[model samples]
Target chain A: MEHYNMNLTLKVWKQKNTNASGSFEIYQVKDISSEMSFLEMFDVLNEQLILEGKEPIAFDHDCREGICGMCSMYINGRAHGPWEKNTTCQLHMRAFKDGDTIVVEPWRSKAFPVIKDLMVNRSAFDRIIQAGGYISVNTGNAQDANALPIDKKNADDAFMAAACIGCGACVAACKNSSAMLFVSAKVSQLALLPQGQPERESRVLNMVAQMDKEAFGNCTNTYACEAECPKGISVSNIARLNREYLSASLSTEE
Target chain B: MGLTGLFLVTFLIVHAGVNACIFINDGGATFNAAAHFMSHNWVIRIMEIGLFAGLIAHILQGLLLWKQNTAARPTKYAMSAANENSKWYSRSMGILGSLLLIFLVIHISKFFVGTKVAMYADGGANDASHNLYLEMKEEFQKWWVVLIYSLGVISLFWHLLHGFQSAFQTLGINHKRYTPLIKTIGVGYTFIICLLFLLMPIAFYFGWIQ
Candidate 1:
C-alpha cells in the first residue's frame, strides 16, 4: 500500500561465457521503488546499461512467477536473495534498506557451469530426472485415481515432494554443494505412491548414480538447502532418499 | 558404514550385558564364568572377526564420506558465522567420528590385539580367567590409560548420540511422528552404553567394585 524510493549499489558478476574469466563490475542505482521485485530492480539496472550502450546483463527469466524458477541469483552471500521460502524474482526491494550494497553472482557449481553473466547451465538437473523419474504408463489404460486407495498421510507426503520445481536453489544453498534434497524430493515423490512401484528399484538406483556422476557432494546435514528452498522442501526428504537407495541396493530382484 | 554401524549397535547391547556381569553376584563364580566364556568360546572368536570387519567398514566408509564432504565445499567461507539452525552434534560429527576412530585404533591395539599376542607368547598364561582378570586390572591401574579410555568413551558417547538416529534416518526408519522417539532412543542408548562401559575401567582403577 506504500512505496518508498531507495538508493542501492551493486557489485555484479559479468562473464562473456562459460570459458571466460569473470569479474565484478560495480553499478549504482538511485530512486528505485521499494515495492519493485528483485528482478524488477534488475530490470531498472539493465535499462540503464542499455542506455549507456553497454550490453544488458544477461540473466535467465521466463514466467517471472516463482513457479517457473528461471530466475537464479546469489545475493549478498545468500542464495535466491535474503528472503526465506522465496525466489529471487519474488523478493521485493522493500526487504533492503534505503542505502545498501548488494552482491549478485551466479550459482557456483562445476555441474552448473556459467553460461553468461547471471545464468548457468542447469541441464545437469535434466539428466538426473531423465535417468529415471516416470513410470511407463499406457495412455489408453485410464483408471480412477482412487483405485489405488493410497493412505491419506502417504498421499499428502507425496504431494509435498511433488512441490519441488527443480530450481537448483538447493544445490546453490548447500555448503557441500549437495543436490540430495532435490534428488530425494524427486525420488520420494514417486516412492510414496503406488504408481511408482514398478520402477521403484531402478528409479532410485539410476537417479542416485546420476547424481553422483554429476559431481554433487554427499549430504552433511547442514540444512542450508531447506533454509533457502523457495518451496520449503524439507531435508527429511533426503533421509527418505537414503532409505530408498539402500533398500534398492539390497533388493535381490533388481 | 551401514552394516558395520548396525553391527556396532548390536555389539553395544551385548558388550553392555557382558560388562554388567561384573555386578552380578559381586564378582563370584557366575561373573568369572561369563568372562571366561567371552574370552575362550569359539563362537565369540567368530563374532570377533565380525566385529573387526564392522570396525574396518565403518572407518573406511567414514573416511570416504568425509573426503567427499570436503570436496563439495572446496572453498572456505570468507567470514565466520555460526549455523544457529543445525544441532551441534550434527555439525561436529566428522570431528567426533575422527576422534572415535583414533580411540578405536588405540583400544583394539592395546586390549584386543594385545591380549591375543600376550596369550600366544606366554603359551596359555593369558588364557586362564584369573590371569586374564589380573591382566585387565593391571592395565587399568595406569592412570594415563584410564584417562585415555575415559576421553575415548566420552567421544564415543557423543558420536553415538548423533549416529544412532542418523543411521536409522538414513535407513528411512524415521518418520516425523517417530523421529522424536528415535532421537530419544539414540541419546538414551548412547548415555547408557558409555556410562556402563566407562564404569568398568573406572571401578577397576579406583578399587571400588572390582
Candidate 2:
C-alpha cells in the first residue's frame, strides 16, 4: 500500500466533565502519516497541545484494534467516521485528504454523558448487562465441546450476535439514541442456543426493562445501527429480542 | 405500536379498494352500491369502532414514544450525519403522522360525517339518494380540498414505506429470507395504495371520473 504524509485541521470537542459546558477546539497536526490510525493522529495532536503548554485533549482508547470499542469519536457526523462498519481506532488518517477539517465529538446520549472531551461514560451498558446476566448450567463436570449438537445456523447466528463490542456506536448512530441494537445482540447470543433456553424469557424482559429505566429511546427500526455498527452486527437480533420480550411479558408470573 | 400501525395499514387497503369501484365507469352506480354497503354493513360498523380505537391507540402510543425518545436525548448533537445511515422518512415519522392526522380530520368532516349522518337519518330505508360518489365529485372539485387530499396521500405514502416493513420487524417476524420479500411487498403496497388514493381526488377534480 502506498503511504503519504499530510497536514490536517482537527476540530475536537473540549469539555471538562459531564456537568460542564463544552465547545470545539481546533488544532493543526503537520505531516501526519497516512499509515497512522486515527487515534495515533489524535496522539500526535495531543503531543502538540502539551508542548504548547495547553491541556491535552482528553479521550478514551484501549486496544487500538477494533475489539475494545473504547474509541468512540463521532468524526465528521458519522459514528466512527466515514468508513462503513469500522471502529474509530481502525480508521486510518488516509481516509482524509490534506488540508481537510475533521470534526470529532463523543457519543451524545443522555445515558452516555460526556465524562470528558470525546469520552462519554458507557457504564449504562454494563448495567443493562447486569440486568439480564444469568444463565443456568448443569455444573457437574466439564462437558465435551461437541456434546451440545447445536444447529449450525444457530451457532453461527449466536457467534455473530456475540461479536458486538458494546461500543455505543449504535446508540450514537440512532437518531433517538436507542440502545436496542446493543441490547438485542446480547439477548440474541443467548436466545439462539439451547443452553440459553432456561433464562431466555427473563433475560430479554429484564434487559428491556432496565434499558427503558436507563432512559434510552425505543427502536424505530431505521436500521441505522446495523449500518454504523463496527462489527457488522445484524438487526435480526433485534427482532429476536422483541419476540423474546413479548413472550416473556405474557408468560412471566412476576 | 406495531399492532396499531398495522391495523391502520389494513384499513387503508379496504378504503382504497372500495373507492376504486369508481373505475368501473358505470356512472357512480357500482361505486355508490359499494359505498352504501360499506356504510350500512353492521360488521363493518363494529369494525369501524375498533378502527377508531386502533387509531387513537396508535396516536397516543406514538406521542408517548416520541416524548420518551426526545427525552432520551435531552442534549442535541452539535453535529450528526443521520442521513448517512437511515432514510429521512424513517426518522420523520412523527411529523408525517401529525400531518396525516390533520388530513384525517378534514377527511372525516368532509365525507364520513355526511355518510354516517345520512345513514342515521334514513334508519334502514336503504336510501340510494345519498349519492356518496356525487359527494366525492363535488367535494374534490374544490382545488383547495383536492390539494389537501394530495398532501395527505403523500404523507401516507412515506409513512407506509417505513411502517410496513417496520411493523414486521417489531413483531419479531423478520427473517433473512422473508425480510427482503416483506420490503418489496411494502414498496409495492405503498405505491399502489397511495396512487389509487391520490388519483381519486384528481380524477374527480379534473372530470376524469363521473
Candidate 3:
C-alpha cells in the first residue's frame, strides 16, 4: 500500500471515573501516516499530550494484533471501525481521509460501565462465563485425541462457535444491548461437542439464566451481532442456543 | 416467541385459505359456507381457542422482550449509525407489532366478536353465523375501514418478512443449503398472503365484488 500522511480531528469520550459524567473532548493530530494502525495514531496524540504536561487519554489495549480483543471502542458508529470482521487494533488510518473528524466512544451498555475514557469494565463477561461456560470432568489419565470420532461438519461448527473473543462488540452493536451472540457462541460451542454432553442441559439453562441476570437485553434477531462480530460468529449459534435452551428447559421439568 | 410465531404462521395459511373462498364471486355464497364451517364445527372451534392462546402468548412474549431489550441500554450512544448496522424492519418490530395489534383489535371487534354475538342472537331468517361474508363485505364498504385493513396488511407483510425466516432460525432449523430456500419461501409467502388480504378490501370497496 502506498504511504501517505493525514491530518485529522478526533472527538474522544472522556470520563474521570465510573461515577463522573462523561463528555467528548476534541483533539487534533497532524502528519499521521496512512499505514499506521488506529492505536498508533492514538499513541502519537498521547505522546504529544505527555510532552505538553497534560494527562494522556486512557484506553485498554494489549496484544495489539486484534486477537486480544482488549482494544474495544466504537469508531464513527461501528463497533470496531469501518472494517468487516476486524477488531479496532487492526483498523488503519488509511480507512479515513485527511480532514475527517472521527468520533470515538466506549462500549455503551449498562452491563459495561466506563472506567475511564475509553476503557470500560468488562468483568461482567467473566462472571457470566464463570456461571457455567465450561465442562467439568474427572482428572484422570489423558484420553487419546481420537478416542471419539467427530463429524467434520460438527467439528467445524464447534470450532467456529469457539472463536468468540468476548469483546462486548455484539452487545455494543445490538440495539437492545443484548449479549445473546456471545453467550450463544459459548453455548453452541460446548453443546456441539461430545465431551460437553455431560453437562449440556444444565449448562445452557445456567448460562442463559446468568446472561439474563447480568442485565443484558434479549436477542431480537436483528442480525447486527453477527455482522459486527470480529470473529464472524454466525447467528446460527444463537439459533442453536435457543434450541438448546428450549430442550434443556423441557427435559429438566418434572 | 419462535414457537408461537410459527403457530401463528400456520393459522394465517388456514385463514387465507378460508378467506380466499370469497373469490368465487358468487355473492358471498361459497365464502359463507366456509365461514359457517369454521365457526360451527366443534373441532374447528376448539382449534380456534388454541389459536387465540397462541396469539396471546406471542403478543405477551413480544411485549416482554421489548421491555427487556429497552432496559438493556439505559444510556444512548453519543453517535450511532444504527441503520447501517441492521435493517430498519428488524429493529422496529415493536412499532410494527403495535400497529398490527391495533389493527387486530379493530378486526376482531368487527368480525370475530360480531360472529360470536350473531351466533348467540339469531336474527330471524338470516342466519347470523353464516352472515360473516356479508359482515366483511359491509365492513370493507367503508373507505376508512378499507384503509385500516390495507395498513394492517402492510404491517403484516413486513412482520412476516422478518418473522418467517427468523422463526425457523430461532428454532435452529437453519442450514446452509435449506436456509436460502426457506428465505425464498418466506418472501413468496409474505407477498402472496398480504397481497391476497389487500386485494379483498380493494375488491370490495371498488365494486369489483358485491
Candidate 4:
C-alpha cells in the first residue's frame, strides 16, 4: 500500500492526577507517514514533548498487540479509533486524512476514575472480575479442556464470552453507562462452561452486586457497547448476565 | 426489572387474551360475566399478587439500573451527533418506561380499581359490565386519551422489541442458528400485540365498536 504524508491537529486532555481539573490542549504534528500505528504516532508526539522539556502524555499500553487491551482511548468520537474490531494501538495513522483534526480523550465513567491524562483508573473492572469471573479450580484438580465435553454450541459461546478483555469500553459507549456487556461476558463465559457451574450462582450475584457498588449504570439496551467494542462483543451477553442474576437471586440456596 | 419484567411479559399475553375476549362475541352479558369472574376468582387474585410483585420488582430494578447508568457517566454527551448510531428505543427506554408506568397507574385506576370498587359502590345502579364497557368507550372517545394510549402502546412495543429478545438471550437461548429467529419472533410479537392493543381504543373511539 502507498503511504501518504499527513499533518494533523490533536486536542488532547491533560490531567496531573485524578483530582486535577483537566483541559484540552492542542498540538500540531507535521509530516507523519500514513502507515504508522496510532501508538507509533503517539511515540513521535512524546518524543517532541520530551524534547521541549515537557512530561509525556501518560496513556496505557502494553502488548500493543490488541489482545492485551491495555491501550484504551476514545478517538475522534469513536472507541479505539474508526476501525472495526481493532484496538487503539492496532489502529494505524492511515485511518485519518491529510489535515485532519483528531480529538482524543480517556474513557469517561465514574467507575473508571482518571489516573492521568488519557489514563483512567480501570481498577473498577478488575474488582468486578475478581468478584466472580473465575471458577474455583485448584492447581492439581485441573481437568483437561476436553474432559468437560461441552457441546460445540456451548464451547463456541464460552469462547466468545472469553473474548471480552474487561476494557470498560462498554461503559464508555453505553448511554446509560451500563457495564452489562462486560458483566454479561464474564457471566456467559463461565455459564457456558461446565467448569463455571460450581460458582455460577455466586459468580453472577457477586459480580452484579459489585458492579452496582461501583456505581455503574443499568443497561437500557443501547447496543453502542457492542458496536464500539474492538472485540465486537454482543449485547446478548448482558442478557445472559441478567438471566444468571435472576436465577441466582431466585434460587433457594444462598 | 429482569425477572419481574419477564414475568410481566407472560402476564401481558394472558391479560391481552382475556381482554380480547370482550370483542370475541360482542355480547355485553358475556363480557360482563367474564369480567366479574376474573375480578372475583381466587386463582386470579393470587396471580394479581404476583402481578403487583412483578410490577414493583421491574420498577425498582429499572430505577436502580437507571441511577447506576447515570453515575457511570457524569458528563452528558458534549454533542448530540454521537446519538446518530443509537436506536431510539434503546436510548429512551428509561423515559418511555416511566411514561408507561404513568399510563399503567391511570389504566389501573380507571379500569381495574375503578370497576372493582367504584362501580360496585354505586349499588349496581349502573350495570357493572355496561358501566365498565362504557367507561372504556368514553375514555377512548376522547381524542387525547386515544392519543395517550396510542403513544403508550407504541412505547410498550418498542420496550418489548428489545426486551423480548434480550430476555431470551439472557436465558441462554441464543444459539447462533436460533438467536436471529428468536429476535425476529420477538419483533413480530411486539408488533402484533401493540397493534392489537392500540386497535381496541382507536376502534372504540371511531365508533367501529360499541
Q: Using TM-score, give the best candidate's number.
A: 2
Please give the C-alpha DockQ score of model 2: 0.83
What C-alpha lDDT, on a 0 to 100 scale, does residue A159 get in candidate 4?
A: 90
Q: Which candidate is the best by lDDT?
A: 2
- Residue by residue across B1-210, what tens digits does model 1's lDDT show? 545677899898987887677665364455557766876789998998888888878878888887886676553332222253356666677789888878888877876676576557668664553444555678889999899889989888877877887777666665778988988987888989999889877988998765
lDDT-based ranking: 2, 3, 1, 4
Q: What is the TM-score of chain A in candidate 4?
A: 0.97
**i-RMS, each model, one decimal:** 2.8, 0.8, 1.1, 2.6
Error of 1 at A86 (Å): 2.3
Q: Write the per-residue lDDT of candidate 4 for residues B34-87, one digit (tens) a residue.
A: 777777689998989988988888888888777766767885533233553467
Report the C-alpha lDDT of model 2 over A1-254, residue by residue, as the tens digit.
78999999888999998999999888889999999999999999889888899999998999988999999999999999999989999999889988999999889899999998989999999999999855766688878999989999999999999999999999998988999999999999998888789888889988998999899998999999999999999998889888889889999997
The numbered model that scores best in DockQ is 2
> Each prediction's Cα lDDT score?
0.81, 0.91, 0.90, 0.80
> For candidate 3, lDDT tens digit of each residue in B16-102?
988998888999998888888898899999999999999999999999998888888887888888777788898888899999999
Model 1 segments beyond 4 Å from truth? A1-16, A20-34, A44-58, A93-105, A135-151, A192-198, A220-224, A239-254, B16-36, B71-85, B126-147, B197-210
Better of 1 and 3 by DockQ: 3
Backbone-clash count (model 4) = 4
Model 3 residue pairs with clashes: none
